[model samples]
Target: MSSDDPPYLMALPDPVGAGKQKFQLCMSELLQLVRVHLPGRMAGAGPSEREQRIALRKALGYLDSDYLIDLPEPFFGALLRAAVYDPDPSFNRQFVEPLRVAFGARRTQEALLEVLRTGTNQERAGAARAWYWATLEMVEDIQVRWDQAALREFVVNEDIDVRRCLLPQLPLHPSHYPGELHPLVAEAVHIGRTHPDEYLRHRVELQVRTGI
Candidate 1:
C-alpha cells in the first residue's frame, strides 16, 4: 500500500499511546513469561511445529503495524546470535528453521528492513537475528560485485549490524578485511552485530550502507 492510500497513509501514531503501548505490553509479558525460555524448550522439536507456526504467524500479524514490532521475537535473534557465534552446526537448524519460516519469507521484507533502520533494541536485535538467518538462506543469490567503491562503503557503515550483516557476504574472503585499524573496525562490527539487541545492529549496518 502506498502512503497516498487513505487509511494506510495516516500519520504515525504516538508510540507510547495510540501506537505501540499494546505491543510493548505484549512484549513485556511474553519476554518475562513466555519467550524467555523458548530456547531451552526448543531442545526438542516434537512438541508441535504446526502449533508453533500458527502462534508465530499470529504474533507477526499483530506486530507488523506496531512501533515495537520486533520485541516479541527475541528468541529468534538468539538463534541468529548462536549461528554467528555458536560452534555447533547440525542441531541448531531447529532453532534457525522456525525463525526463518515465521519471519523470513513470510513476513514482509520491507518490515524487516524498517525495523533494522529505526526500531528499538529488542526490535532491531530480533530483526537482525532473523535477518542473519534470512540473508544466509539467500547468500548465494546475492549479486557478486567487483566494485570496490560500493563494497568499501558498505563495509564501513556506521550501523554495526548493517556492516556486520554485509561483512559475511562482502568480499567473502577474510584476506579482504585489512590488517591495520581495520581489525578495530572488524571488532567493533563484530560486537555491534552480535549484541543482545537489534537496534545496535540497525545502527552498525547503517554505518556501512549509509552514515550513523
Candidate 2:
C-alpha cells in the first residue's frame, strides 16, 4: 500500500476478511444471518417454513439503527437479496442510510476503486452504485479523478448491475464527463432502455424523457 492510502486500505490478513476489523465483523454477522434465515428446503407450507419465517424476522430485528451505521462489504449483497426475498420496506429504509454513510466516508474513493478493480461481480456492482451515491451526496468532496475512473470502467462493464449504476448518473451530470464521453453514455442509455428489467428501463426512459 502507498503511504497516501488510508490505514484501513492496507492489505490485512485474509482470514480477517475485507475492510478493517469492524467491517469484517459486520460481514461475518451478515453472512450468518443469511445462512440462518434461508428458507427451509421444502417448497410447500410446513413447520420448516414457519421456522424459517421466524428466523428471518429475528435477522431483520438484528439490523437495528446502530447496526446500519457502517455496514459490511457483504451488506450490499444482503440488501439486494433482502429486497427480493424479504421485500420489506423496513429493509430499504435500513439499507440505504448505511450505504450513504460508507460512500461519504473519507477513504471511500480508494476503497471503492479497489472493489471496482478486484472485488467479486456483486461487490463491483455495489461499488458502482456507491459512486452514484457519492455524486449525489458527496459532490463537493469528490474529485474529477473518481468521475473519470467511473467513465472508463463502467461504460463497458460486463456486469449488468454495474452498468445500471452509472447509466442514469451520466445523463444527469453530463458536465462531469467530457464531450468525448457522450457517445459512450448514449450507448449505455440505449442499453438501459432495452434492458429486460422493468425498473432499469423505466429509469433510462425517465432520464431520456426529461432530457437531463
Candidate 3:
C-alpha cells in the first residue's frame, strides 16, 4: 500500500503467543500482502544487502502488533499451497513437504481441489501448475513400475482445469504413455478449440502441430 493507505489495512484485535507479544492479522491482509509485493518487489530490491535488511525490518515493523496469526484451516491450506510453489527451485522435494503439514494432507485430490476453489486467483493458479510439476516428479519416481494407463488414471485429476493443464505436458515425455497418447492429444485439440482460455487454446494448438 502507499504511504497514505488506511490503518485498518493491517489492523488486528487479538494477540497470540506468550511473552513474545505476537499480534494477529486477518487472512485477507496476508493475501493482500502476497498480492502486493511478492516477486514484484524483487525487481528493485535494494542498494545493498544491509539496506535490504533495514528495509525488511521496517516493513516487518508495520505488521500488526498481533503478529502471531492463527490461521483457519482454509487459510492454512492456502499457505501450504503458496509455500510449495514460491520456494527455492532446488527444493522441489521440500515443496511436497507442505502436504504433510496440511489438514487435508492424505486426501490429495480433495486438498488440491479445495485450494483451487477457495484460494486467491494467483494462488489457485500456482497450485494448479504445481500439480502438473508434482505429477512429473511422481512419474520419474515410479515409471519403471507403473504403466501408462495406471499412471494417467491416478495423475489425471477429475478437475478439467487440472486435466487440461496436464494434457499438453504428457507429450513432453511421450515414450511413456504409449497406450493413451493419441486420445489425450485429441482431447488437447478439442480443448484448444473449445476452452475459454485463449492461452490454453494456443498452447494446445502448438502442441498438436509440433507433436510435443
Model 1 whole-model lDDT (C-alpha atoms):
0.40
Error of 2 at 182 (Å): 2.6
How much lDDT does each candidate structure score?
A: 0.40, 0.48, 0.39
Model 1 per-residue lDDT at 112: 50
Model 1 poorest ten-residue lDDT run: 8-17
> What tens digits encode model 1's per-residue C-alpha lDDT throughout 1-212?
34454331212111121223433343333333334543333222222534543444344332243422343466455434332222222322344454455556334334455554555433443344444444445533222221132244344444443333333333423354445535555665675577765544545554444332
Model 3, residue 120: distance off in Å is 12
Clashes of each: 17, 0, 5
For 1-212, candidate 3 gives per-residue lDDT tens digits of 34454322211111111111110122233344533544332232254534533343233222332321322345344444443344222222233333333223344434544555555433343444445434432434333322333234324444444444344444533454555575653554565567775555556556545566
Local lDDT at 198 for model 1: 54
lDDT of 2 by residue, 1-212 (tens): 35454333111112212223433343344446556443341222223534544443444434344534444566555543332222222332333444445334434455556666766655555555555433344544454555666666565675555555545454434555788876766666666777786656767666656564
The better candidate by TM-score, 1 or 3, is 3
Q: Which pairs clash (backbone N, Cα, C closer than 3 Å) in model 2?
A: none
Q: Model 1, stretches more than 4 Å misplaced?
A: 1-96, 103-108, 120-129, 135-156, 159-162, 171-212
In terms of lDDT, model 3 sits at 0.39
Local lDDT at 144 for model 3: 31
